[model samples]
Target: MALMRMAVAAVVLLDLGIRSTDLEAHYTNLGVLPLHVLFERAWNPYEFSIHNMSGLWQVQALLFLAAAGFAVGLLLGWRTRLMTVLSWVMLVSLQNRNPMIAQGGDDLLRMLLFWGIFLPWGRVWSKDAEGQPAPASYTHFSAATVAYVVQIALVYVCTAFLKNAPEWTTEGTAIYYALSLDQVLMPGGRLLYPHFELMRWLTHLTYYTELLLPVLLFIPVGTAFFRTVFVVVLFSFHIGISLTLFVGLFFVINFASLMGLLPAPVLNWLERKLGPATQRCAGYLGGLRQRLPAWQLPLQVQATWRPRARKPGYALLPMLRETVLYVLVGYTIWWNLDGIIAPKYTMSEPLRWFGYQFRTDQHWGMFAPAVFKDDGWYIIEGNAANGRLYDLYRNGRPVSYEKPYSVMALHKNDRWRKYSENYLFVDNSWMRPYYCNYMLRLWHLNPRNPPLKRLDVVYMKEVSLPNYQVSEPKREVLCSCEY
Candidate 1:
């Protein structure tokens, strides 16, 4: 127990130390005022605009300082409940203020911190009590521990299920898309663009591993070995993402979530360290009692010599109920295999066309009638004016041409325009704007011959475009142009 406590303490100390420098930088850059601007004015969930107190800098700063103080108090176990609430408020404010800079980690950390409030974490290893006997009931610790574990597992499982796409599995092109500028990888990621084959194999392996990780949790034969491997792979994956992607602080938050995996022994040791002072105080009270007269002893003390009643074991029904609950949970997971393994992919021919058109930004325009061959669709792009058109193959063949109105009508009926408009100015709007803007810019650059019209016919083929680049047009124009 003592060794476990020491290990836990060491881990906590190390985590705190590593985070300190980054935390200071985060505080300095964000501060209090900017956060207030976000919370008091920005729209809920979609912080698109600011509404009030646009320039009241001092007030914002004060609020920020108060929030920071509260967070520190919560972490140190001082007035923890109040501090926890304040910390959550402050954390949300900070995140909302600069949503662009926030990452997945901040969200995860805030959730974990919220759970911490319900635990008796402060009763031991805190300044309020240098030595104290920690609470024996496992109520708080057990619940929080379980919640953290479940949440972490869900995160991985959900992500794995979401990535079970044709591009991810069959073509292995998901990593290529992720590393592309269209995603959020580092600027120099193009250096690895040539190694698509390697990336494809790696992507498949990653997908398989993530999908199988949850099942590995319940297996006992080599559980520790599996856990170590899982941790190492996940940590390494996160490190790569942090170094090569612009996901902000998501990795940090995930690392913190792993703290729940620590053995229970560490917590017990911390309780012992907190007991010495409590024992001394108990001794002092005992001495005071010794000095009292014999008649002054409380009736409860005299009665203590009687045998105490023992609690009965749980009834058969209650035990059976718990067993049933465990079985149900396992069954629920197994029954949802469709949601877990086979996500909504293009199951039919018509659906495949809709899927391709839907995936591409052509929801409203005419789509060329193309057959879904073995290796995806075949498509083309053409330039009519100069009779200079490039053959665009998607997977490896030529694609049939569809009318512009057909594609446009589909997009309009499906409410794609609304979807695009919402994201261009709302949350989860990350890469959508860049893609839209690039297309619009391309059209504007060739204004007189608007590339869309000039491309009289496009033959769709699946061919990789190497060093493909699009330049911004000097003139700005509305994207909605009449054909």
Candidate 2:
């Protein structure tokens, strides 16, 4: 639990820091959607957000900074419950502020944090734990624990089932297409793209692993061995992906979730290694306890003196807790089932109403059924006050100068990279506003430097396997902004 909390806190901090760089553009009233409409149209009724209270960029920035501080508090296990709740609220708020930039990884992180709010993850290896008695090593179980394991398993199992395409099964070309795509690929992909046979074998292995690994997790025999293998293989796979693709926090978030499943034996080994350090830390806290007023210390420190005595009321409390867990479990199960089951079981309106309320509404499709074949990049054009046509993208050059694999370099970060990919799809209506936003951004950057005119969505279609031949670039005017 401690490891999971630390990993989650780290990822949240990184995500917030990344978004902080573009606060005005991504998080405030000045942003493309603005804060007011985002609250009414994008935010779920159940979500708690300071962003909804104000549209001012400064207010958003302050909230972002506060969220970052909360993440740090979560990492250190200080005021764990409060920190967890604040982190979840900020995550949901920030994502809703700019839904266009969110991807599957963001959804997964949000759900994990929501579940985390109900878990005793900060009981050990945290500042909260530090102030406890002589030793902090402890263990307990809750319904939330069971739900967490199931949630991670469901992610992999559903993804495996959804990958029922010829590209993944017969041809083993999914990885080939994935690595070849200019949008997400890193330099490592360029080096890996030439090895067709190797990539094909890897594709098959990837599918089989995702399909079978979750099953092994449930096997009672040699549970330790199974978890060790799962942790090793999945961590390696995510690391390889990170090296080959700019997937934002996807790998880190998923990898951190796996820490929750680390076998007790492994955790025991870790505990043994850190035992001495913990003892010294605990002793220091013990000394502090001697000097300070008992009430002045944090609650965790105070708890040692007045540990709750078991009472008859505890029996009723457990029943109440389990009842709430049952409701959450049912909702979560139905949530996943509706997305994948045939004929699609629809939850009642009252239940479906909770979709955004808890921010657990999810779609688990991750490169499923089929890998994309048509991969490309965008080329924005501008007509300057000098009456010259500039690429707007390629340092004021003609569109021909646009590099084939420049998408990785062009985007500010992984969020924009995924946004670009989504913008190219025919179904994404948000592209118009995004394009308009881009023109406005350009105007702000320089009032007359190649004054903005129009933007184009040009796709430099990539070559697929067996044929491995590039096609001519295709261009379409997606949106235009005057003045």
Candidate 3:
């Protein structure tokens, strides 16, 4: 659990750093998603975002800073429970601010942090321990424990069941279609692209792995052996995915989620193999903890923030907490099951609102059902004041209809790529002009560059077809912003 906390916190800190790059563009009123438009179009009443309390980027920056601080606290296991809840809240709030930028990985990360709140993370390798010796054994079980393990299993099972499309089975070409997407192609994926036969076989392997491997987690005996096997297999599986796809942090987050379930055996082996080094590091960390007296004041200020273990007779808090957790777990299962069993089902208002309120609603759509066929790239066109047209994406160079050599690198990161994917839908047309104007404003920041008269957010669409057939690239102007 300590390892899981560190991994989740590291991912959160890294995510904040990457997102801060586009603070204004992605999260401010001055950029793409102004709060008024968001509340009007994409908002959910139950969805809460403290980041939206202010329109200025400065406020968002302050929030980002606070979130980073909490992630650091979680990483170091300082006030573990408090840090975990704060990290989860900050994560959900930031995600709610712009759901367009979110993906499966973001959901996984958020869910892990939410469950982390109930798990013990300050036991070892944590400042909260303050030189407390390691537990003689690393085995435990609780409501949170059961929920965490099953949560990981549900991710795979739900996704596998949702993939009812024939392409994943009879066609066995889901991987081919997925890699054919130039917009998200990775360097390693290019090498394997020619081996369609291998890709075909791998597709079936992936399906069964997701569908069956998670069952081992529930085996009644040899828990260590089965858990080890599951971790090694899926860990390698996602590693292969990372090398062959441009999924931003999805693979990494999966790796972290898997770490929490690693059986006692593997961890014990690691400790034995690195005993000397581990002891030295532990001593150093213990000394560091002793030196840090300042960390305790704020921790005391927020003393009421942490949950106290109830007295033997006090049943109300325990009962209420347990009831809510069980309801959340049951609701989560029902939500996923409804999708698989009744393909066209929506949760009734109360349940749906509950999901939104707690941010427990989730679906692991990692290319589920069918591979996306809209394989394309964006072309940001700028028309300058002196009858000059430039390709702003190429740094104000002459305009061209041709695609770049590396289309995958076009997006700043997976967030933008996911946002761009959302931008492709006609229902999201309202977002285009904001993006266009945002780009225009950015381009004019350089005084050497002439002001643009207008800007065009264009997408060159290419639809992927069966048997390696490719459609001609179509020039589609998604949004035209007049300056």
Candidate 4:
């Protein structure tokens, strides 16, 4: 089973290599604009800014080479650990350099690489282990397996549970907006927009599948069936997003996750096909040991003769405990669904006062203009009547201030303005109005913002307000500027 999986992984790697040139072209082009921005900010570094790359293009090129090398190593199963590590590093660096360009697959790929590292992925099918005795059993349940399964489940569970929001369920319109969004991002977006109905159905299916996936995990027969279904659904999902959003990274990640669903027989077959060279390598190592000096020979023998620990019995008690724990954890996750799906919209009154709008405004002209300033430190000032300033920091250290302006005026800020000038400001007012309305129309979505209760306002005025009045102020005094 392990060998078959390795073979499958190799095949997948080959496919990726074949597509590398085209993918690299897209990656390189997407990164160029950010690289230029980073170069411009060569003096000061910002957390999502590219200010630190001394030789930005060179770094990107090196990363591409590293990714290619890792892929080759993966295919050959040579230095599998090192290769997996390098691949992860390359992919993560690329992602961190410009997260905006990354899609869902990029996130999944990075995680899957970590999972691959945890498994003895190279034990049976690797060139490095050629001719070594293959393990008697291949289906040992390790922490890596548990972690990988848990992580994958989390993605689906969270995504599904989160869709409980009015936007996803009520109108079922999330699909329409998502599909329509491509028209503005891609060159020929208009052509894709007409397929709104298809996109809508896709969206519905996605939400439904994600929501029910956790149940499928526990079902005996359903596990394999659901895994297959998920792969197909995710692949189609990635294809849709790629075509519409022009994001290919998500597609790769979804493809990689398919490894989890592979059968044991397939992996074993691969090992048999590739085990010869591995055996030869082991023989060579044995020969080298024989050539070792007398002084070191005893130590080597001692190292090889270390007593193996007895394996623990898989008793019913532990199984029951694990089952109970899994159920409890699942329930906990289900309870926290709101936080995962609509983090911005689901806050308490006090938190909402902090200008944490759950759903970010998508339309133009919703923002106010403001001049942001720092005195060897940071403070943001907003231009609109309801605007408020902010102090930004990370890890208790001050970084930069974030001045909240209407989405329309976000570009007016010198720092952000440049990003909008070249790249389409998909979040700006120009795009938001159509998207929000279109989504609302299709989904029959209701705003998540809670209505201001009369009693709640009275309490707020006394506790949180600057002054109180009988008739509540028509214009809201936006949140405070304190951290």
Question: Which one wins on TM-score?
Answer: 3
Location of the lowest summed lDDT over 10 successive residues in candidate 1: 360-369
Clashing pairs for model 2 are none
Q: Would you estimate the TM-scores of all the predictions?
A: 0.48, 0.87, 0.92, 0.49
**Reference-based lDDT, each prediction:** 0.42, 0.75, 0.85, 0.42
> What is the C-alpha lDDT profile of model 2 across 354-447, one tens digit per residue?
7767688877778888877667666666665666666655665766735564577878888877767766667665556655665557555874
Candidate 1 matches the true fold with a TM-score of 0.48
By lDDT, the best candidate is 3
How far residue 69's Cα lies from its native spot in candidate 1, in Å, is 1.4
With candidate 3 superimposed using the best TM-score fit, by how many Å does residue 49's alpha carbon deviate from the native? Answer: 0.6
Model 1 per-residue lDDT tens digits across residues 1-483: 112122223333333343333332222313222334335443353222221233344444555556656655655556656766666555555444444343345445555554454444554334443333333432333444444455456556656666545766577766665554322335435556568787778777767766677665556677555655666677787776666544434566555555445344333454467546645665788764332322121212222122345456646654675465444334323332334455553133433342122111011010001111211111234333444443222211222343222222222111222232233343533423333333334444664632443222121222223233322212211122222
Q: Which model is ahead, 1 or 3, in terms of TM-score?
A: 3
Where model 4 places Cα greater than 4 Å from the true spot, the runs are 1-53, 164-167, 184-202, 220-245, 265-338, 341-483
